[model samples]
Target: MSELTPLDKAEAAAKEAATDTVAVQLALAAVELAKAATAQQPAHSPACSHQHKPGRSTGEWLAIGCAVCVGGVGIAFASIAIAIGGISVAILAVVLRSLWRDYQRDVQKGR
Candidate 1:
């Protein structure tokens, strides 16, 4: 292997310094981001924090389960109602149109 010349050594040192400077700048940017993230959050006072209770009780969970079941049943019933109502409305429209045509024919015939 050939010995590195002074110029080569100087270039290598300068590259290393540049890499270190970039690393330090990235680290500083990360720290600023972390600081900004923390600053964005609202600081909760100890008293205010305690006022809001965390987690649900067994009764609350049971109530939620019942509500979900009822909601599912309601949605099923609503879907059925909408389907039947749409079919009924379509049939009614067809019947009404035919009746209207017949009435017009009778009127034209002076009946």
Candidate 2:
């Protein structure tokens, strides 16, 4: 390759500087756009006003209480059913064991 002349070197440097300047300008424009967007928006929006009412009404509280009571009763019934099932399984096991023992005893006596 031929050696670059001073004029060519200066032109190449100018082109590189132009590209860098454009990139910096674009970054600055983005920052300005963001600032403008934030300026247009209110810090405390009127749409988020919690001025109407706070906390539950009397009827709402009553409904919540009734729901809790119903849930408790359902849980109690489920516990009772589980207990009855456990007792039934235990009784069945005991009866089966007794029958097996009697059968074995009879077989031994016959032999």
In candidate 1, position 51 carries an lDDT of 57
lDDT of 2 by residue, 1-111 (tens): 599999999999998898779787898899999999999997887876566768898999999999999999999999999999999999999999999999999999995
Residue 45, model 2: Cα distance from true site in angstroms: 16
Scored by Cα lDDT, where does model 2 land?
A: 0.94
Candidate 1 whole-model C-alpha lDDT, 0 to 1:
0.93
Q: Give the Cα-based TM-score of candidate 2 against the true structure.
A: 0.51
Candidate 2 lDDT at 91 equals: 100
What lDDT does each candidate get?
Answer: 0.93, 0.94
Per-residue error for 8 in candidate 2, Å, reads 70
**Model 2 pairs in collision:** none
- The segments of candidate 1 whose C-alpha lies over 4 angstroms from its true place after superposition are 1-54
Residue pairs clashing in model 1 are: none
Encode model 1's per-residue lDDT on 32-77: one tens digit a residue.
9999999998787354545556899999999999999999999999
Which candidate number would show the highest lDDT if scored against the true structure?
2
